[model samples]
Target chain A: MKYTEEHEWLRIEGDSVVVGITEHAAEQLGDVVFVELPEIEAVVAKGDEVCVIESVKAASDILAPVDGEITEVNEALTDNPGLVNEDPQGDAWFFKMKLDDLSVLDDLMTEDEYKDFLG
Target chain B: MSDTLRRTPLYDLHTELGGKIVPFAGYAMPVQYPMGVMGEHTHTRSHAGLFDVSHMGQVILRGPDAALALERLVPVDVAGLAEGRQRYAMFTNDKGGILDDLMVANRGDHLFLVVNAACKAADIAHMRAHLPELEVREITDRALLALQGPGAEAALNALLPGVADMRFMDVATFDWQGHALWVSRSGYTGEDGYEISVPDAQATAFARALLAQPDVAPIGLGARDSLRLEAGLCLYGHDITEMTSPVMAGLQWAIQKARRAGGAREGGFPGAERILQELADGPLAIRVGLRPEGRAPMREGTVLWDAPEGGRNLGGVTSGGFGPSIGAPIAMGYIPTTSAQPGTRLWGEVRGKRLPVTVCDLPFRPSTYKR
Candidate 1:
């Protein structure tokens, strides 16, 4: 799993990768009341806004970490957005995408590097 | 945190309780605790939430001519406010604009006031400049705390007896642990609550005692704002600005009948002519509650248009966010009087997306104030 400066995490699995917001992002957003997900098979570029997470305070945009086509979105988030706050890294993963460029993963940060970057 | 940002009496307490500190009105205040904004907001509605509102300014008005001096600045019927009661009031400018909204409590011997934190300094200066002959003392040595929700009265009553008996809008001074504490049965969350003014020295211990209760949890500004928005309450600078009039803000109820047309004390305060004229007819624009069409919450400063694509701009959103209690996106903003009617369809342009919205009756949720 790798993390982006925008607070999103990506886990590479073969030609596909799973994505979700970092726990830090979840904490900063307070409570996750609603999550607007991208449609399946939607092409998105690196750093492009793909979804939105609305909390009680404000609405925040979630951006794609790398260029790819969204293969599957977490449908469970539509009904129970609280999963993002409860287990952001696991059950609350936002979407899975088919990787268009594997080299983009090298640009991301590891778990330890993400912690140091936050510090 | 900015070094220049002032800290409240409960600053250390907020930190100890894991509150996320943010700069608000020149003060480092908690925006939410570890429970998060949504949790705190819901806790306040169902149980009780304790808020550290010490950043707000507390003032005391005294002397023989105090009431008359205050009456000259605000349009509310100050003289008519009975002893041991609080009334919502606003300071208006010569142009009929709201200088600031405030709470006026007649404590019998002297009048007590609580003003918004951001406008406190300017409010004190305005009062001192206008009423130089009367006594205006800013009570800086005290901290103000609000305990709000359905369980507020029960939690507070455990600390101080007889608070449950005090009806809504009532104010009185009572002894707590041998210290004199001034309390008012009022709050901004539209819940049955109490605002207690305590000496700064005892603020920490007092707050700790309240938090020890099963029904009480330390809430922060984030939930405080959401709760007020759910209850359709206006924020000071955002919803009700100096450019907005009380009448246009839908605050006509704050203006007493005695201060209106043909009454004994008609047209004495600032902007009297314009306010009275509006009261007779109606303001060109009025603020109303709004419900957006979809999941995307329309934020403040979003332009409201007559049509979905393009048309005449109606007004703008002053306060907009998700209402946890309502379980949907809700908002409040100014619109033309013609469009102010409930069920009027409108469109809000946000980030280039035109979203449908509807004018609705305030309080997206019913007020459970203990009146």
Candidate 2:
């Protein structure tokens, strides 16, 4: 698992990575009411705002952790956005992207490193 | 290293209940609790939510000429306000701008006034200056709590009976555990609820007692703002500021008929001429409700234009957020008088994207107040 400073997390699976926000980010954003995702086949770079997660408090950007092309977007979140708050890590995965360069994954923080960074 | 923020009487209770503290209006207030903003907001709409509103200013106006003196400052019919009734009013400046909006409750012997925390100092000073002979005493020895929702009356009446008998906007004094408790059957959420003024010494215990009830939970300021916004109520600094007028803010209904032209007490208040003129002829800009086309919610300062691509800049969104009860994103803002009617089409520039929006009526949701 890889995490970005912006509180987004990614998991590698074959040639693509599954993306979603961390539990901490989900908790910080009170209630998840709406989620705006990037279109499939859209190319995104690291630190680019590829999606938006809106809560009752405010709307926050979900930045891409690595350069990739969007492969799949979570269609279920359109009807039930609260899934992101309920299971931020598992079923609530925001999107999947095919990686352009595999070396960028090593630049992201590990799980333990992200914990310390949060503290 | 730095001065600490002021704490209310429920500060310890808030921390113990896992409330997230934030600085607001010079006081450290709880923005949300462990239940989160969404939970608190839904609970307030369904059951009941107890709010620690101690930071708001509570004042007592006493004197034989208090009502007459107050009418000179506010544009409301203070002289006609029946005893034990509450009236929504605002302090207008010389140029017809709103200084602060407030609630005035006539308690027979004295007037109980509640003003916003940020504008409390200025409101009190303005009142004192205008009514020099009248006694304007700021009551700091009390803590205010609002028990609001559909279950509010049942939960409150379990301890103090007959509170449910009071009509909307009714104010009365009751004895709670041998202490004088002032309660008004009114709230900002457009729900039937009560705003209780309790002694500071018993505030913590009283709050805890309310939480022990079946339907009461400790809601924080975050949910409070969302709830009020969904109810289409105005926030002082955001919606109606010193630069906005009561007429432009769409609060002219608050001015009683007697306070307007050709009434018993006609045009005796500040900015009366301008307010009456605007009443006869519409104002330059008016506050209206804006409903965005899609799911994305617009925030304050989002530039509104007449056309989708680019047109004349009409106005900007003042307050916008997701309304939990309505299950959609809603907003309120000021637009030109020409496009203020409901169903008028407009476009909002949000995050560099031009989103289509429709001009709708105020109050995204219907009020459930028991009138």
Classified by CAPRI criteria, candidate 2 counts as high
Q: Write the per-residue lDDT of candidate 2 for residues B128-204, one digit (tens) a residue.
A: 89899889999999999999999999999987788999999999999989999999999888778999999999999
The candidate 2 chain B region of ten consecutive residues with least summed lDDT is B1-10
Backbone clash count for every predicted candidate, in the order shown: 0, 0
TM-score of each: 0.97, 0.97
Runs of candidate 1 exceeding 4 Å displacement: A39-41
Q: Candidate 2: deviation at residue B216, Å?
A: 1.0
**Residue B180 lDDT (model 2):** 91
Question: Candidate 1 lDDT, tens digit per residue, A88-108?
Answer: 999999999998779889999
